[model samples]
Every structure is written in structure tokens, then in C-alpha cells.
Target: MATKVTEMNEVKSSGIPGLDTLLSGGFSQGRVILVLGEPGTGKTIFISQFLYGGTTQGNENSMFIGMNEPKSRFMIEMSGVGMDFDALERNGKFSYVDATEVRRIPEQAKVGRIHVGGRELGLVNLIDMMQEGMAKVTPKRIAVDSISDLVFRFPTIEERRPVILDIIESLQTTGATCLLTSEVLSTGEERTVQPEEYLAEGVILLRRLPRKGMRSVQVLKMRGQKVDTTPRPYTITDKGIEVYASEEIY
Candidate 1:
């Protein structure tokens, strides 16, 4: 949930204490935020917290469109962190759209738990499905688990670029604050810039700390907000991703 922004810079709380402080409030209202990290850096946990917090605490409607994971597995994983997506859905505050099996499933067919229908499940079809889902739930906060699956579905960069841009553009039109997760190809000091990093209005990067299993989070950029770009230590606690904004990474 977010406060009504009377001014252009007014923000909403990310619901994560240290993260909100690092964001200087929270993410800009209705803007697309890119959460970038390597596989185990808790990007999913971050977005899950955002949506779950909004629906459960802020009285907001939320949706999750997952492209790489099944709804069952996703729910089980989130349950470990104390999020009951099933309950939220039962209460009409949450919705999940699973697109993991789009490539293999035939049109208008049910593959296990996912239902794929109407067209061949390409980029265009996925966007259409998203729009349909939006019309039903009309969420205020939305998350696309990882746009990387859709990004890499095509063979070339020329083809991939427009697909991603189109998806982002479509999300922007929904009037919902959106969080799109993306995987970092390289985890070391040097990393290539991905298109989503520059395209989204805000970017949050997570990195694995060199000291064993810890993690670090940084706000790379936020278009209309004064952001703290400092790298802060964070950890995946039982509740969820917790950031130590004022603490040094050592």
C-alpha cells in the first residue's frame, strides 16, 4: 500500500524498514521498478514482500505474473517466509498468473496446474493475458517475477529489445506500481548493463557479500527521487529480506 502522493515526489512505503530508508521513503508511485540480482540474492523475496505488504497491510490489491515458476512452487517458497498467497487470493486481494509452461502447452489446454489458451503464448499473447488479468483484479501493485524468460525467449537482441520494452510500456499503462525482476548475468565486480536497468524508472541491485552467505543491496537509480546509492548489507531472515541500511557492509 502507498500514501496518496499530493506532490510529484511523494512516495509509498516498501514495507521493509531499512529498504524504505534507503529509498528515502519508498518507490515512486505507479512507476516501474527493476529489481536486479543474481539467482540466490533474494530478488523474489523483495518483490514478494512488496506485494504481500501492500495487500495485507495497506489494503491494496496486488498481482503476481510469474513466467519461470509454477504457482504451487512459488506459493510454497513464499510460505517459508510467512506469506500466505493462497489466503490472500481467497480473500480477493491477490491474483497469480503463471506463464511457465506457455512454450510447451497447446492452446486452450490445461497442463498440470497452469491453463494456457487463446493464441500460442508468445509475447503478444502474454501481454493480452496480463491485460485480461488486470481488468479482473485491477491491482494497485503488480510484479512480473522475472522478465528474463520473456526477454531471452527470442533469438536476437533486436527481437528481445522490443518485447521487453513493450511489456514495460504495457505495465506503465495499468496505473499500478510495477516491479520487474531481472537476473544479473555476471556476479563479480564487472557486469554488463541490461536494457531493463535503464528502461525502468527505478533500479534496485542486489549482490552476494564476499563474507560467506550475506548479501548487499543498493539503489542504482530512481528517476524522480533523491536516492541513496550506497551499498548496504542485507540478509534473508525468516520473515523476509531485511536490509541494514545504516550498517557498513564489512
Candidate 2:
């Protein structure tokens, strides 16, 4: 069964090991969080863990909307990381929306609790699909694997900012803790802050350190909570992402 509705100020565990310690508990309940990182920086795995953990441990229904990856590949890859979405779906605690296509989805279409198949989706249709799914299952945790596709459709940041806000607003309407993954587009050493970083209620950045193959996670900002904001070492284990919150990334 899905968890009960929480107050706006309550903390909701992020579902990743050691991550809660950094957030003084977890993300602010029902707020949207931006998970910023480059390709292969474990962004997908991070959100998968959050969703899986919520269903298995927190008794919360979870939804995953994929904008970049196919549902088959995503399920297979996530299986390698020990997230048995198949089982979760069987138990009626998980749902997956295949939104790889950004065309348009029918409003009257039924939303599935296991996997809602869609040929294409637009920004408006995407929000409609999410609302239909939320109305169907009332999931307490929702995640979008990556919003880069949706954001890049706009020519500039100014155009993208309002779109991102609309997405966030749709997510918050259900009082579910939302996590949206965004890609960092910088090729140079220095980083360019994304507009979503300013729009989200929280921002968590994952990056590859100077040392070869070493990864780190940092919480840049989390509204209504005092986050550590430290650059902590992390790893993508067979089970899932693990953050060494007690240790520093030196």
C-alpha cells in the first residue's frame, strides 16, 4: 500500500545508503529535487534506488518516467543493480511510464499500475499522463530519469526555465517527493549551473573526481533542511548507489 500523505516540512528518506545522514534525515517531503550529473555518473541508478527503496522499505508507491532510455533496457540494466522492478510491479507498488517518445498521448487512455505504454508524449501530455497515474495509484514518490530531452527542446535557458517550472509544479500537486535527473552539458573543466538547479527545491550533484574512476556526490541545496553539502565519495555497487557520507572526497 502507498504511504500516507506527509506534511510539507516532514523529511522523506532518499533511499540511498548514507544519503539520509547528509540531509539531516532526507529530502523535504513532497518537494522536487534535481539530480544533476553527466553521462554514466550513476544518475539513473541513484533515482532507481530511491524508487525501489521507497516501495520495498518505506511502503510508498513509486513511479518512474523515462525520457531517454527504453523500458526494456532500463529494466534489464536496473536488474543488474538489484532493483527487481518486476517483483515490485507484481506487488502493485511500482509503475513505469515509457515516455521515450515526446509526441502526444491520449488523455482518456487508461494508466496502468505496472507499465503504462505510450508511443509518444509532449510536455502537456506528459503532465497529463503523470496526473492520470497519480490519480490511479497515488504514489508517494515519483522520479523522471532525465529531463534533458524535454529541456533541450527549448532553444535557450530562458525558454527552458518556465518549462521546468511547469514540470515541477505538476509533480508537487500530488504531495509526492519528486526527483528529476538532469544532464550537465559542460565539456570544459568549469561547470555551468543549470536553470533547473535554481528551480528545484533541492539539488544533488554527482561527478567523477580528478582521480580515475572515482565518483562523488554533493548536496548543493535542500530547502527546509540543513544539508551537509559536502563532497562525499560514492560508488555504484551491485546492489545500488552507496554514499560514504561520513567520509570526505579528497
Candidate 3:
């Protein structure tokens, strides 16, 4: 008799109630997901809760790569949402990497000069830092606060593509599921080229729709997974992001 090889989908719970169902039971393991949204759309809060949830429930370590926010400010903001980032760090279950140092490198490469920004601190260096951090903490979940800042820092898309690819490859090697956030820039007509969306295994969009006087969230896409296509409502509470069921909202 021949033995059948069973394929399994690695899944990580989002920690938000009703979210897993929307994500086909959760995000697939070792896959990169791009979270797109505008400002005040609760993108950071959502990703933070994801890491905290994994740490608390699954005992999984997590690493957060911040491009804009400093460590102190990041912690303070998270604290206001009832997430004890300090405690998680103290427990060795969470880690943070500040990419601001790399950002400080001047952009010497002019348009068409090379491709991307001056290759001072390329993706290789960033990957090195990420690997070093992972070696020490061995996190199962990772989050890159925003890739848009990194992209803008670059001089051209050609240069940015390879660096982004390198980062994605590095994350896959770490065997950690990663959530990469990006800011959406519309061209007033239609959304322009979003390379990250194409590069990632899954993409989730958080958009603010102007309602009677308030805004609501809508999940745009989750590739290769069955998700709640209906735009569910959500709120930023003292305990982070809370997604309401479609039926419950109406």
C-alpha cells in the first residue's frame, strides 16, 4: 500500500474575534501579508494585537520592525490600547527593531543614477539585523510596521524591487509569518502599481468608508483563502481592534 502525503496549511490566529473566519481560519504560516490602509485606520493597532495575541495565547515570540515610530512612543501607544508591550518585551516574548538608523543614510543616488536610493544600508543589512534579532528571540510572528517609508526612501522602483524581494526571502528563511504594512497612495483615478501586494502571499486592505458621520472598515482581499467577503465593521477600543460580525453590526 502506498502512503499518502497529507498537506497541511500552517495557520496563525489573528486574536481578533471573528477575524479568523474572515481569513480562512487565520493567516497561513511563513507567508507574508501586506496590510494596506490610510492614516487612522487602526493598522498599527491591528498588527500589534496580532503579535500580542500570539505571544499570550500560543506562547509564540514576536518581533516588530518599526520604520516611523520610536520604541518609547510605540510602547506608549500600545499601552493606551491595553497592550502591555513593556511586559511582553520583559518576558522575552516580543522584540523591536528600529530602522530609523538606516533611514538616516542620505539618498545620494539621483533619478536614473543607479535605481534605488544610495545603497548605503541595503536589504542585506536589514536582513542581517532581522536575523540577529530572530536568533536571540526566535519569534514565530513578525510585523514590519510599514514598507511605504522604505519604498519612498529608495530612488527608484527597480532598486526597491530587489530589496523588497530580499526582505521577503529573509523572512521566509526565518520560518516566521510576517505582516507588512503599506500606505496606499491613490492617483485620483485608480490605484497605481502596488508591487508589495503582488509580492506578498496575501493582502488585506483596511479602508475607511464615510458613513452617516462615521467611518467603517472593509476587508479588501485575502488571496488563496476563503474569507468573509462582506465588509465587517470594527472599532478601536481600550483592548485594541474589535471586529464586529456582519449580522451583529446590522
The local distance difference test score of each candidate is: 0.83, 0.84, 0.75
| lDDT, candidate 1, 131-240, per-residue tens | 87797789989998888876765667767677778888999898888999999888677888887787889899999977998789999999978889999998887788
Per-residue lDDT tens digits for candidate 2, residues 1-250, read 9766559878878899999999998877799999999899999999999998888899999999887777888889999999999888778788888877663343233446543433223577778768777766689999997888777767787788888988999898889999999998872457778899999999998998879878999999988789898889999878889999999777
Q: Which ten residues in a row have the lowest lDDT in candidate 1?
A: 102-111
What lDDT does candidate 2 reach at residue 17? 95
Q: Can you tell me which runs of candidate 2 are displaced by over 4 Å?
A: 1-6, 103-121, 187-189
Q: How many residue pairs clash in model 2?
A: 1
Cα distance off (Å), candidate 2, residue 61: 0.4
Alpha-carbon RMSD, each predicted model: 5.0, 6.5, 4.1
Q: Arrange candidates by lDDT, highest first: which order?
A: 2, 1, 3
Let me know the TM-score candidate 1 reaches against the reference structure: 0.88
Question: Candidate 3 clashing pairs?
Answer: 117-155
lDDT accuracy of residue 145 in candidate 2: 77
Worst 10 residues of 2 by lDDT: 113-122
Better of 1 and 3 by TM-score: 1
